[model samples]
Target: MNPHNPNRHNLGTVISFEFRRTVLKPKFWLISLSVPLLIGVVVGLIALSGQTTAQRVESQDTASVTFTYTDASGLIDPTVARTAGGTPVSDAAAARAAVVAGTSQCHIDYPKDPLSQPIDVQGKDLGLFDSSRYNAVATTVFTTSIEHKIGNPTLAKLAVNPPDVQLATFADGHATAGIAGVIAPGIFLVLFYMAVLMLGNQMLNVTLEEKENRVTEMILTTMNPTTLIVGKVLALVGIGIVQGLVVGIPASIVFGLLSGSMGLPEASAGVPTLGSIPIDAGAVAIGFCLFLFSFLMFTGLLVAIGAVMPSAKEAGNTFGVVVMSMFIPLYAGSLLVSDPHGVVSQIFTFFPLTAPVSTLLRNATGGLYWWEAAIALAILAVCGWVFLMVGVRLFRTGSISYGSRVKIGRALGWTTGR
Candidate 1:
């Protein structure tokens, strides 16, 4: 039997058994369901809290204002101040007439000295159409005045921004919708963070599991350790994908149903929002690709460590080395979000193992070089080969021996027939 053929080495049996345990196990389902459940509960709680606050503000801010504009032309700016906020009133005469008819709240009188008040609506508890009956429109009119004063063009199309008086986040009212706007991006940041840790840690567990059970030896007889290891890593990656979707779905759905953004208060609510907590398809693809490749490379290293370590405890020390390699890339990816083209980001982008995470992050938030993507992929592929070679050496070295830890010096000396 050819020694290089894993089938002859007993590796194939282990691969099949690894597939069965991972695919049929309840643990797979647990991992898949975990992220989603966690995200749903957190988002639901936040939404609930925001709604409760909205109700309190609506009730307390009941002061109203009525503008009496005797003349339309003289009524220059019939802005009203009231329960919600302030707005410019173009049809002041009609509104004023409504006030006389008890259909409106207050009136704005532009006395001959226009500069004295200078087209600004003053006084309090004001509404153009009467908040008691038409509080909604009345509130709109009050806030429009402030939008005009602020020189916002969005008010022209939207004709309303969060009421100007909502000058402070909670201002006179609860801003559940406003705050929702802020939470959108926050959700993505958090999910991305969770995915990395979840996938990375799981990869570690799996490598240790195979070694601890002594299954690696059984599988090496039929398939090359490289193929066996790579396939197992791919399968685990598929599992991670399932987990990510489960968590992101509900947060996206609930956020979609509500109005506005995730921001505590959108700089201007009602302005078109990106809406739909979307993961960039390109970013997701690139990120996952990077994650998977990085995962494979690390998995190879893990497998080798697991194979040689006498027990799982010894494996922990080996992981420290893996952690060190990950640190630079993790930090680079994070900072790349801020300045993808910055010197540090550009430097890390060239490194194969670290490049995957950093380059993808740059692709997601910051624009990275077009050529860098291809380069990063090719570089990682090569790195994967080198890691595969090391892993096989470790496996071949320790597969037949079962004793204390396998030292690196003896492990590398395998090629020299030491």
Candidate 2:
């Protein structure tokens, strides 16, 4: 067998060993299965709560509410009151008597100066009335009456029938994409966040565990440190892919069901639901590539850090910086949402640690230039290679030094003897 090729048999053995050890662990199964299950349960509860609320509102609106009112100012004619969906009573005494006798659901008293003084409302069950609808109707009646009295026909006409302003953006005289432009990016961002958080922490813990338990020494004796690291990293990537599918598929189904049951459009009028948002296959492919490369780069850095630490606790203490770098995009999420092409977003796109999320967001939002994305990906690939080489060197040299923690500068100074 050639020294480099080292028999495909050996590499397979290493990969199989790592894969089985990881996949069969109870912790792995727990995390992979629980996340999607929890998300589905929560979404179901929320949908049920919303449905219950809607039923209550519909029931309330359908119930008849006979309202009697006395207009002391005489501005409100009996016709106007009737048209406004209220029964006109002859006097305040009549309105009050009707309400108290349960003949009417509510009584309204319009003051002498209806505009200047507050309107007094008495109801047997205040909750039964939709205050918003009643307030709107009362406002229209008072404003119309005042305008009529003032003799401003134009103002009255404008008040009664406001100009319908349908705002639209034209791309070469055609309407551009609607709410999906805003929403699709948000969905991509969330998915990217979940993937990185779950996979990155797993990488960190796995790498640190080998160092903490002194297993690196035993493994290094049989396999090249670089080979051992590569095999483990590949195994973890496989695990991550499985875990992502496990969580994402069920969550997506649940989200779709929730959106449909709630009468959410697949992307027309209001908040865009998952089914409604149009996904660009090409953009998604590019985003996946970026995510993959970024994950490798982050895992490499974590593995390098773990190799230098004396124990898992120490590695964790220093892992905060790496975690913070991964989440820098989250901290600047507002800037990305408000102005994806702004200076802040540009900085994030170019910076390796923040590039994955920033590029995905800009791509999803249709703000990323082709050249910018190409450059970002190139930078990420290079950084990932450098990190992998550095991690291999650190693990090779520092694995035997268990007396104290290895400084990063010293670890970087060490080189593989080719």
Cα lDDT tens digits for candidate 2, 60-159: 5454555777788888756656766778777878778777887777777889985599987776645544644445456556666767676887877786
lDDT of 1: 0.56
* Structure candidate 2, residue pairs in collision: 266-276
Top candidate by TM-score:
2
TM-score for each model? 0.58, 0.75
> Weakest 10 consecutive residues, lDDT, candidate 2?
264-273
lDDT (CA) per prediction: 0.56, 0.70
